[model samples]
Target: MKTESSAELTLRGTKTESRVELTLRGLVLGVVLTVVFTAANVYFGLKAGLTFSTSIPAVVISMAMLRWLGNTSAQENNIVQTVASTAGTLSSIIFVLPGFIMIGWWSGFPYWQSVAICATGGILGVMYSIPLRRALVTDSDLPYPEGTACAEVIKVGSGDVADKDSVESSGKGLKAVLVGSLVSALFLVMVQARLFLGDVAHSFRL
Candidate 1:
């Protein structure tokens, strides 16, 4: 028996065309999102040595923005999200790149050198992923927690998921994420403003 994946079910009847998927607007949005996310990723990585996945956020933002621009298709937003996520994720190179500066290997980043490094890294990643697509993503049963979650986000945004229960569950998940994000942002703002200490440390002998 050929078991269908949740992604197959969610993406049913959603294939419009490759032309729409590669529209000028979609490409422009993707580039804009890439710049935004890469900058944010570099900043966060350098500051805290941590970077969060921007895939779901990019998907959600793409869907919302394209909807506002007028009639939009899932394929277009897929391009937008893919570009943004790939660029943002790969920008983690900042983690190692900065070390060169810190170790006095270079005084400042040379623009062409950084560009070449990023381009080569991105190309190698794509080359490796092409071979692994079937073995890891298609044939394997390994639970991809983050990939699954991002798919659910896209499914809910697309509103064409075949399973009613899946749509409802994904909707709930999206709402939870929104509420949690708002609360966390508020708390962070308060902490930054010194409304309350974000951490407390006291030395005592006991």
Candidate 2:
């Protein structure tokens, strides 16, 4: 199947309109996901000294939620994930900033100062990165693994099922996702329970 480019989709009026992409429902869902992911990231970072990317999980959750809500579209789901992932990333500030307090740099986190620091740093990063967008994303042939995976999820979730084969294919895809999720969950449980060695090297001593 041929994929539509942004310009082509716009010309064909197939792209999502601004109103649809910025609906109240989508924003509300984004805010909810952002809060949950941010809190989870903060807790994980504090305890484990690390946090995983939230983009894939946010995208999957957004797609599933929007699909269940009905009348929602892929662009709306994208918007929701964008908002959520931003919050997830920003939560990393909690990882380092608290060290200042622990080291007696401050008695507590200053609300306005923290906001100012984060906002300024984010703005500067965005400004500096804007010039490299084309070179990094468009000109380069780099495989953006996370981005590609999220796009695949969107494509599968948004596929039209006007025919029997398409319906069957979508069903298979859904089953694959469900099975993968279950397998992952089982592996995590085994690791947590110490039933499975998380690191083979450690278990076998190289």
Candidate 3:
């Protein structure tokens, strides 16, 4: 076995240390750049379509932006950008799904029914991906750019230096339960108190 002198060992250690620092720096910068690009994707999509498309292209654009702004390695940028972009894409899908009912597509059903379906679909999307994680991340090399981007955002944003704001979303089923209950109770109270009259006293002439 070849033994290295202490000086050679020290030099190698320093080189490794430098590489790690550089990698960290790249990741931090990539995270910021990715956020900017994601905002742009949402703005442009809303402008163009009055709705956002959750296609992979938006995230791909963010990755490109990371390269441009951070001058990081393509592989590193891809990892973070993929994650950030995917979040926006998935969120857009959740936001837009309910609109299907607005233009007469889902008219016959109560509005709350449409809302429930959308909320359910949003939750299901997350669950659906869980089973596919191994296949998508490992076996297929599917280039789930959005998933990669989302992971990156979480990793980067969790840092002390990142913004601390937090937001939570719930399914429409829960919302509907609350709102519907309130509305129904109010309606019942009004009807029972004779505050509002229905066609209870009307006689059909035809």
Candidate 4:
């Protein structure tokens, strides 16, 4: 038997053309996640000068939500993650554009200006990335670590694995998620209560 290529495996074993993949519920969930992740990215970018990728978290959240709904599918979760990741990535613009207003370059981020800048940048990015997708994702031997990890997540959550392995994996994933969530919640509480210094030190005093 011939082994399936990565591209083929990526496309196969899932419903690629199902209407459920683009349902109103899924779109709404995606939009909600997009907003949440975008806000989180903006906060972290401004505070730490860094932003985490929303792809993995979006995938896991989408999978959990769909699983709870009892009609989970890989395609639907993929769509949710795609939408959320796009919105989260666009939040990076917040890091640069606001500085212009602060330094007397622009009075403020005007509605039309912000829209135009984001739209143009997004379109140009998509245009440039098409070739890069072919070269890097399809042709190159480079290990796309994040993409590989996301694929593994999707596969594990796809429910195509053997029952025993699936149960074991799911249990571990749940435990990890719970621990992470608790830690994050605790950190947020500490910051809110001023129990921990969440912001960076701007000055040193003897």
Model number with the top TM-score: 4
- TM-score to true structure, per model: 0.71, 0.65, 0.32, 0.75
Which run of 10 residues does model 1 get worst, by summed lDDT?
1-10
TM-score of structure candidate 4: 0.75
lDDT of 1 by residue, 143-165 (tens): 67766766666666665655465
**Superposed model 2: Cα runs more than 4 Å off:** 1-19, 102-104, 160-206
User: Mind giving the per-residue lDDT tens digits that candidate 4 earns over 128-152?
Assistant: 9998776666666666677667766
Model 3 has an lDDT value of 0.45
Candidate 1: lDDT over CA atoms? 0.73
Residue 151 Cα positional deviation in candidate 3, in Å, after optimal superposition:
17
Task: Tell me which of candidates 1 and 4 scores higher on TM-score.
Answer: 4
- The lowest-lDDT stretch of 10 consecutive residues in candidate 4 is 1-10
Ordered by lDDT, highest first, the candidates read 4, 1, 2, 3
Candidate 4 regions off by >4 Å?
1-20, 102-104, 164-190, 193-206
